[model samples]
Target: MRLSNKRKAPLYNFINTALIMFLVMGILAFFAEEMRFQLLGMEAYLFIAVPAMLIIIFYLNGRQIFEYDSDGEALHFRNRNIVPFMSTPLSDEFPKYKFVKFETFTFLFFKRLYITINSKSGNTILKYEISYLTWKELNDLKFSLNKVIKNNKEKVNDE
Candidate 1:
């Protein structure tokens, strides 16, 4: 099975632009108010708080394109940010039997997948951003990963 979220990456540009536009509008509106001191309620709060909160939340999301391929004899994983400069890309390929385990976790809006793989030196864990995947895609990924783990167990038994 193969899973990819590359198609959805283009939407980030629109989202980023919209967020910036909202922040700019908020700042402009706040300054445009003639009586800055008179503002002392939700109206004043919304102008600054909302935009700042948006930026902070967006930064925490770390929206990265994720690709996973389990074809032939190896499993492939690729993770890269659509923003380019945010982080270095992670590309890995290893044998099916070497896949030790896989886990997932979410913090606030941040979601990630951690894959543990076996090696001669030690077991290494890989992290992938899964914040942008749809429900179907996430399920497919879980299924694929479980299948690999099952296969790995079988191979161990045979050995």
Candidate 2:
């Protein structure tokens, strides 16, 4: 099975970048203001510059790539239009374990979606807030993953 999405970068990358940029800029602005007050009589807001740059970089160059190929036994992910962020092996054991439950919750004032996957091995959770993804894409991913769990359970039962 081959599943792919040609969407923009993942929302997580944007959020992470924004947050880090905010902090860095905040500090820089504080120092800039302090220096100006001490050395010169002019007041300046240098902190805003860093965050502005971050926003531009994120919007212009940010890209996300999601691909899952069951036949090839790989799941590939790329973020920020840079090197691949994740390349996980598609374990054959996935199909044998039953899906205990799966849930999605809204966070950050409902600006993001947090998906929690629970199986026999435990729980794996991922959060996304990008507007580019559709419900169908999310559902299809879940369905494909469930196949692995089902197969694992069947094998156990047969044994």
Among these predictions, the greatest TM-score belongs to 1
lDDT of each: 0.83, 0.49
- Determine which window of 10 residues in candidate 2 has minimal summed lDDT: 87-96
RMSD of each: 2.4, 8.1
Instruction: Tell me how far candidate 1 lies from the true structure as C-alpha RMSD in angstroms.
Output: 2.4
Question: Residue 158 of model 1: what lDDT?
Answer: 93
- What number of backbone clashes does candidate 2 have, counting pairs of residues 3 or more apart or in separate chains? 12
- lDDT of candidate 1 over 3-28, digit per residue (tens): 88888776877777788889999877
Candidate 2, superposed: residue stretches over 4 Å from native: 7-63, 72-132
Q: Model 1, 125: alpha-carbon shift in Å?
A: 1.2
Candidate 1 has its poorest 10 consecutive residues by lDDT at: 33-42
